[model samples]
Target: MTGDHYFSAQPSTAIQRRDVEFTVAGRDYELTAAGGVFSASRLDPGTAVLLRKADLPPAGAAGPFLDLGCGYGPIACVLAAVAPRATVYAVDVNARARELAAENAARVGAGDRVRVVAPDEVPDEVSFAQLWSNPPIRIGKDELHVMLQRWLPRLAPDGVAWLVVAKHLGGDSLQRWLGDEGWRVERHASQKGYRVFRVTR
Candidate 1:
C-alpha cells in the first residue's frame, strides 16, 4: 500500500480502476471505482452502516444537503436518488475523489442534483439542511475534530447530521466532544463495530 491516505488532498499514486456494487434502502448501485480514493475496491463498511442506520431525507425534503468527505459520491448519489428535489453537495479535499464523485453522480443520473466540489468551494453562507459522512478517521483526531468543527456548525437551525465512526476510533469520545461543543448528539445506532451518530445544534 502507498503512504497516501484517502484524506490526502492530491494522491500521488498511480491510478488503477475497478468497479463496486452495493445496495442502500433496497436500491442497488453499481459504480466505477479507482485508486487514490476512499475504499476504491468496495463500499466502505462505515458508509454502509451510516446509510443503513441514518434516517434518509423524505422524498420532498428540500435543498442543500451535504455529503462531507464524499468519496466517489456514494452518499451524495444515494441522497440525490432518494430526494431528487434536494441539492446534494458532495465535498472532498481530494481532487481525484471529487472527479470520481462527479462521474458516479452523472452515471447515476443525479448529475443535475449532485454538485461535487472541493471543500473550500462551498460558499460559507450556505447552511445545510442535512449532512452525511463516513468521516476520515485515520487523519488523526485533531484534524478530524477541526473538520467537524468547521462543518457541523454549518447545519441549519433544524438541520441534522448523520455520521458514522468506528467504535474503536474514538466514536464515543467524539460524541462527548460534540456535546461539549453544544451540539445535541444521540447514539442512533451501533452495528458492525461502527457508531452511527445523529447530531444537531
Candidate 2:
C-alpha cells in the first residue's frame, strides 16, 4: 500500500480510477473515485450515515453551499441533485480528487452549478448557507482542529454545518471542542460507529 493519505495535496502515487455508487434520500449516485482520494472503493459508512441522518436542505434552498473535503464529489453531487438551485462548492486539497470531482459533477449534469476547487481557491468573501463534510480526521488532531477553525467561521449567521466522524476517533471530544469554541454542537445521529454532528453558531 502507498504511504500517501487522501489529504495529500499532490499525491505522488499512481492513480487508479473507478466508480463508487451509492444512494442517498432515495436518489442514486455513481461518482468517480480513484487512488489517493478518500474512500476510493465505496461510499464511506460515515458519509452514508451523515447523508442519511443530517437534514438535507429543501429543494428550494438557496445557493452557496459547501462540501468540505469533498472526495471525488459525492456529497457535492448529491447536494446539487437535491437542491437544484444551490451552487455547491466542492473543496479538497488533493488535485486528483478535485479533477475527478469536476468530472463527476459534469457527469451528474451539475457541471454548471458545482464548483470543484482547492480550499484556497474558494473566495474569501463568500459565506455558505450550509456546509457538509466527512472530515479528514486521520490528518491528526492539530490539523483537524485548524481545518475546522478555518472553515466554521465562514458559515453565515444562521448557517449550519454537518459533520460525520468515527466515534472511536474522538468524535465526542471533537464535539466538546466545538462547543468550547462557542458553536452549538448537537449529536444529530449515531450509527455504525460514527457520530453525526449538527453545528451552528
Candidate 3:
C-alpha cells in the first residue's frame, strides 16, 4: 500500500473514480471524484457547512474568485454556477484532484469560467473578489498558517473570504490567529461542530 495523503503532490494510489452529488443554493451538482484527492467519495462536511452558511456571491456579481484547496471543484463549480459572471480559480496541489476538478467544471457547464490549476500556476496579477476554503487543517498548525498567510493577502481590498474549520480541529484558534494576523474576523455561524468564519480586510 502507498503512504499517500491527499495533500501529496503526486499520489500513487490507483484512481478509484466515482461521482459525488450535492445540492447548493437550490441547485444540484454532480461531480466526478477519485482516490488521492481530498474527500474523494463525498462532499466534505466542513465544506458543506461553509457553503450552506456563508453568503454566496449574487448572480450579478462579477469576480475573480478563489477556491483554495479545492478538492474536486465543488466550491469552484458552485461559485461559478451562482455567479455566472465570475471566473473561478480552483487551486490544489494534487495533480489528480486538479484533473478531476477540470472535468467536473466542464460537466457543470462551467468550463469556460472555472480554471483548475496548481497553486503556483495562478497569475501573480490576479486578485480575488472572494476566497473560499475548507482548509487542510491536518497539514498542521504551522503549515496551515503559512498557507493562509500566502493566499489571504491576495484578496482584493474590498474582498471577503469564507472558511470553515472543525471545532475539534483548532477552529477557534484559527479565528484568533486570523484576528492576530490583522484581518477582521467574524464568527459567521456554527453548525454540527464546524465554525464558519467570515474574514475581511
Candidate 4:
C-alpha cells in the first residue's frame, strides 16, 4: 500500500492527534483522530449518514458485530455503546488507525467490548451478527471488491451489513454487483449524495 494511503499497514504521515465530535442516534461522540487515519478532520459525512440512516442494534441486542475498515473506531464505539452486550470488532489495515480506534473505544467506555485489531487478527471461526462500514472507496474498485469478498462471507447466515458509499463513487454498481453475487441488497437510504446499502445473504 502507498505510504500515505489510509489503507496502508503503517502510515508514514505525521501523527497529529485531534478530536472529532459528532452525534449518532442522539448520543454524542468525541473521537480521537490522527494524520494517517480516514476522515481525520471530522466525522466523515458518509459515516454520519450511515449511522443516521441505518438501524443500529438496540440496547438489548447481543452481537458479534463488525466495523469493517474501522478508522478510529467511531462506528465500533457507537455499536458497543448502543449494544452493551455486543462484542464489536474494529478491523483496519492501518496500525495507527487501530491504535487510535483502541484509544477511542476506551474513551467511549467500550474498550472491553470493542476489539481493535489488524484485519488478519480476526479469527476465521468468528462470524458477525451485523457489519457496518463507510468503506474506503478511494482505495480503487478492485481492492475494494477484494476487501469486501474477504469480509462479507464471514457474516452469519442471517447477518446483515450496512455500507455507505458516495453516489458518484459507484454505489449503484456495487449494489448490482452484490445482487449478482447472490446477496440481497437494498438501497436503504440516500442523503448528502451518499447511498446506504443494507445487504444480507
For this target, which candidate reaches the highest lDDT against the unseen true structure?
3
Over the stretch 145-175, how does candidate 2's per-residue lDDT look in tens digits?
9999999999999999999999899999999
Which whole-number lDDT from 0 to 100 does residue 196 have in model 2?
A: 95
Q: After superposition, how far is residue 71 of candidate 1 from its true place, in Å?
A: 0.8
Clashes per model (N, Cα, C within 3 A): 0, 0, 0, 0
**Model 3: residues with Cα > 4 Å off, grouped in runs:** none
Ten consecutive residues with minimal summed lDDT in candidate 4?
1-10
**Candidate 2 colliding pairs:** none
Residue-level lDDT of model 4, residues 82-200, one tens digit each, is: 99999999999999999999999999998899999888899879999999999999989998999999899999999999999999999999999889888899999999999999999
Q: Which candidate should be chosen as best, given TM-score against the real structure?
A: 3
lDDT of each: 0.92, 0.94, 0.95, 0.93
Q: lDDT tens string, model 1, 1-201?
A: 468878889998678978899999889998887888999999999999999999999999986999999998899999998997999999999999999999999998999889899988998899999989999988888999999999998999999999999999899999999999999999999999999999998
* Model 1: residue 44 alpha-carbon error in angstroms: 0.6
Model 4 stretches with alpha carbons more than 4 Å out = 1-3
Of 2 and 4, the candidate ranking higher by lDDT: 2
**What tens digits encode model 3's per-residue C-alpha lDDT throughout 1-201?**
358899999999889999999999999999999999999989999999999999999999889999999988899999999999999999999999999999999999999999999999999999999999999999899999999999999999999999999999999999999999999999999999999999999
All models, RMSD in angstroms: 1.2, 1.2, 1.1, 1.2
Candidate order by lDDT, decreasing, is 3, 2, 4, 1
Of 3 and 4, the candidate ranking higher by TM-score:
3
Residue 168 lDDT, candidate 4, scale 0-100? 95
